[model samples]
Target: MTNSAANDDGELSLRWSGRVSLTPRILAVNIFALALLAGGFFYLDSYRSRIVDSRVAQASSEARLIAEALRSVEPDRRDALMLRLAGDTGARLRLYDETGKLLADTRALGLRNMVLRDPDKQGRGQAAARFLDAMIDTVVGAARPPLYRERADGFAWPDVRTARSGNLIAATVWRAPDRTPVITAAAAVAGQGVVMTTANATDITQTVRVERFRLSVVLLIVSLVSILLSLFLARTIVRPLRRLARAAVRVRLGRAREVVVPRLPSRRDEIGMLARALSDMSLGLRARIDATEAFAADVTHEMKNPLASLRSAVESLSMVKDPDLQTRLLGIVRDDVHRLDRLITDISEASRLDAQLSRAKFEPVDVGTMIAGLLAQREARGVERGIRLRYDHREGERMTVMAEGARLERVFENLVDNAVSFSPDGGVISISATREQEMLRIRVEDEGPGVPEEAREQVFSRFQSLRPEAEEFGKHSGLGLAIARTIVEGHQGDISVESREDRVRGARFVVRLPLADRQ
Candidate 1:
């Protein structure tokens, strides 16, 4: 890549890196928020698990009670015992023989009695009995032991005989169950395979729903709180930076002597530390600029006297010498004297402004009135070299500003004189003023050879000139525009030159000054 492109890339990289480095503060806030959410999840998980375990324990107790009641019934009278138990417990009851054969059922007996008493009740009851039988069979076949226990618990099944479908079958004998094993009452019942029970999940589901709603509400509140806190944090972090940026821009435009960093939060954070450091740096920079300006002023002042004496001596020598040699020597001496004078003047003015030598006493001045007065004064000099001058006040009464009258007049005098000097005989110089938002813009346009494009940016640099043609012709010092710029900028304003080509086809200098605030 070209050097300029590479330099631009390097600058961009530095800016991006600087931005990335500032993200740690934002990241810290996010991490804190994440920690809060994680803690909430952990608390909810534990709470839900406890609720589930409590429900499971309650279901296990109920299952054990029913199993023990079944064990208390004798084999032959089990049908009547189950009927009484079902009425007391409000549950369906089924009894099976030792051989797993269908015997007598309480629901079936109810249907048979209904047939003897009422025919319609008998049909309805019988249908209901069949449905209940099928449901019990399905449930019993599906049941499995909730947990396994070792023989160390001291229980075993006894062998017995039974009959099923006209065939003999073996039956396992079981001992009486203990109440403690059944209802927090420990008891060993043999030959009774296994029993299972389940609790209603509706309450658990409701609890879960409530917990989720509460969690969502908590998270919403946390999110809202986090947003408000983040906004406050971002403002606190960025306000000082924005202030610094504005101050830097003002300094670059030569409108301020030093940047004043505002006080930050009392906490000793990185942002606070950076503000302090930047304040120190600005102070140091202002001091260095002052020192440089003082040195330049001293040098310029010291050189002026010697230069004036040398020029006087050269003029005195020229008057006594032979015509041909004297003319050539005189021209060389005069040119050298003019160059020295221009250099001294530019250096002096630049140093004075940099040092902020003094403030011009302010007064209410009408810009149009002042321009007219100056033009009349210049015309009285009787040096009209065929250049037509015109003054136009388009803004009328709006062009007035608060300024130092004499200083303001001197600024216009320099501009007008410079335009007159550059204009060819019969060329025109126009002065105009227009009102812009919060400012007054004054322009001086001359139809002469204009400044070169390449040299426009550096035209206000001290002693720098784009006047090669003038230098060859041995006429015109180049400090006029530079001095004008300094005076204009001193008023918290800007001055710039606009030109077309090397030859001064037309040159216009625009000055913008802030309008006086009335309220």
Candidate 2:
């Protein structure tokens, strides 16, 4: 409520209300990315299995083709032919006779194991592939499966048994004794023996492993970006809200230190609206508190005057000997008591104004009808001071507005009674209503001394009196105008004093209220 805080509020603010925390917001945003990463991990596991199965199929087909080549060659020269086949398939080829005895071995050539160990070692293109494999295993902890050794001790293996039955079986891919991927296949060569192929499936496994490693790197990068974004959100949105909350607490506690309310109008979000609402509410509370305190002080001061006069009269009555003087003194005591009663009554009404207005249920009121009805009652009572009450508006017309009808009637009655007291003898109090755009304009003009420009506003303050010279003091309570102003404003209208348009000696009070949409 200080001038300093008021001035602080008027300055332009570049800050907005969206100071949100990035932590929670970032987590919310990354939800989709996390789901995608989960799906990728699942896909990788399935893809690794598929790769092994595909390599097994390929190895089986290679074994069948090599078996056909052995059948055409002479049995004695088959070993030299087997050496040529081993170089192509990168597998150790073995020939087994019908009795399950090993007839010839492809490793006699010494080139088969070298080819299987590092098939792509001779090519520079695969060097990067090997390095990536090592890196993926290091970072992701992709443990190698145990190696497998094929039993060839004159016993029929699954592949050899199935192949001799002409089934051309391909075994599942497994790990070799050297930690390389392994698969087996067999095919029978007519009048020769069964050709068994043992293949290292390291290429397929490495391919899947490298791809999964790339995906993991991508996921790590995305997680890092999401965290940074969350931090940014926290700074932009949440920080300002916390500042507002602290400012509100200071204002509520009536801190002696001035707290500057934030004026972050730049934001288009709900935070901007909240800041503005809180600022307005705080200012309103401060004004109400100041007004209530001032009103209470004024009430105490006003009440003291009557109490002092009555006390003086009572003390004087006991000492007076003259009967006539004693009667006059008693009357003075009665008059003081009456004044106190009237003052207290008006004070009570003024205090109840806010709560009564808040609890009042509003309805559409015909301003023309309300004023017309009030004017009739005042005229029927007959102004003892020879003041004539007149109501003027368009014939057969009405102007309505949303208001608490009974309370609004009280507003005009107070204004009229005040005007009657202030008017000269044989004076006419003119009340008129007219529609102006979307507003209803009403005026009460009195044939009395027009208010001075400086004193007009002060007249509506509690305990402020500007009564006529002829009017008896006790009959008028200065609170009438103040109460009238409060009631008018509570109805969302303004009441102001002005010089009457057609006369120089009379004062005019104009009221403008928003017109109701329906009759």
Query: How much is the lDDT of residue 38 in candidate 1?
Result: 43
List TM-scores for all candidates, in order: 0.41, 0.84
lDDT by residue (117-163, candidate 1, tens digit) is 22244476445533433343354452221221212111121111122
Top-scoring candidate (lDDT): 2
Which ranges in model 1 have alpha carbons more than 4 Å from their true place?
A: 1-324, 327-346, 354-358, 394-398, 468-477, 499-504, 517-519
Candidate 2: lDDT over CA atoms?
0.79
**96 in model 1: Cα distance from truth in Å?**
92
- Cα RMSD, each candidate: 18.7, 7.4
- What C-alpha lDDT do the candidate models reach, one value each? 0.57, 0.79
Lowest lDDT block of 10, candidate 2: 12-21
